[model samples]
Target: MVTPFQVHVHLRRHLMKELPETDDAVAQWCRDQFVVKDGLLDKHALEDTFSDKELQEIRRPVKSLLVVTSWAILVSLGALKFLHWSALLSSWKGIALSAIGLAVVTVLMQILIRFSQSERSTPAKVAPAKPKNGGEPSETRQNKEQ
Candidate 1:
């Protein structure tokens, strides 16, 4: 999961400007600038600011972390069920283990919730980039010039 701090760092590194001091402000800035539709960053909207390689770099870690965390929770739940079925949960050690598992799941859930909240915020529309010449878009003008 990508924390607001991580998003702030990425924005700072990519945009090279001072950002809002608070995490919520930084997150809001991201929502305003980028197209986040349905809890996902729109890569097409990011094309103007980030290269394909950079987009992939930003996406990979979050995807991998989510997958790993989800699998961990599932495995932990399965283990807890097995322990209970075998009557191991009757012991103090088993109770401790269950508590630890519950705590881990709780933390993971909180992370997921935060991420969802950040991504699911209302996204501002990105206006099309217009050419200063006022004849055509920059891309088309560039193509014609070439």
Candidate 2:
């Protein structure tokens, strides 16, 4: 989600610097790929961006996250049940514990997902090598020669 959203932001920034023709192209792409409606996304337009394989790749992590989150919730509930049965926590304490547990799980999940996505989002930048003769790059010189 973060990766795709970041790409969208980058594309928007790119569009701002481009010419009107380029702007039209970018706008068309955005219209086809994303559907924003009343400050929310339109599900059908969003689905149009990816093919079946890409959708499956996205679904894999989401499914995993759901499973992990469910497990975390269950564990938190189990802990609360234990605390209740043992009388180790008062009502306020139980509520506090549940809130803290939920917060921790949500934060950790976000951090882990963001970390994983970051690696894919940023590629190593390679500066073009300067020509030894120092006029223009060899490719440009070659084009002039022809």
Candidate 3:
């Protein structure tokens, strides 16, 4: 339920905390980035200060690690299969079972990646109920009266 603005502030604070050891000037700069004016976040100023370059820098190592880990896992599995053919391919024929396992894993990964993206902040719109007497919903009627 965390809002985007909350995320922005939290990230700013986290960076400010972490930046001091690397460079005091950068830490001070991050602290100055999220100054709120007139009770609203200065979003443009925030974006200007903490640009996408910083985000990309953070993501680069993690992505590289993931790619390397995925390759290592695949290689290990291949090695295991080569070492123990009977154990890996005992039941349900041979290639068919492997193909099915690969297909299932691929489909599940696709589903997981698709759903992991950020969701819409707005609530879903619901169709107003059909009035018993063919009129607006009672909530709307009450609001109009007020």
The candidate scoring highest on TM-score is 3
Error (Å) of candidate 3 at residue 133 is 38
Query: After superposition, which runs of candidate 1 have C-alpha atoms over 4 Å from their true positions?
Result: 1-81, 119-146
Displacement of residue 92 (Cα, Å) in model 1 is 0.4
For model 3, how does the per-residue alpha-carbon lDDT over 102-123 read when each residue is reduced to its tens digit? 8999999999999998986998
Error of 2 at 106 (Å): 2.3
Ranking by TM-score: 3, 2, 1
Better candidate number, 1 or 3, judged by lDDT: 1
Who is ahead in TM-score, 1 or 3? 3
Candidate 2's C-alpha runs over 4 A off are 1-80, 86-90, 121-146
Off by over 4 Å in 3: 1-59, 62-67, 70-75, 82-92, 120-146
For residues 47-123, write the lDDT of model 2, one tens digit per residue: 54422333322246678888999999999899878877966466778768767977999999999989878454577
Please list the C-alpha lDDT of all candidates, in the order they appear: 0.68, 0.63, 0.65
**Worst-scoring 10-residue span by lDDT in model 1:** 5-14
Per-prediction TM-score: 0.27, 0.28, 0.31
Residue 25 CA displacement from its true place in model 1, Å: 33
Q: Report clashes for each candidate as comma-separated counts.
A: 0, 0, 0
Error of 3 at 6 (Å): 33
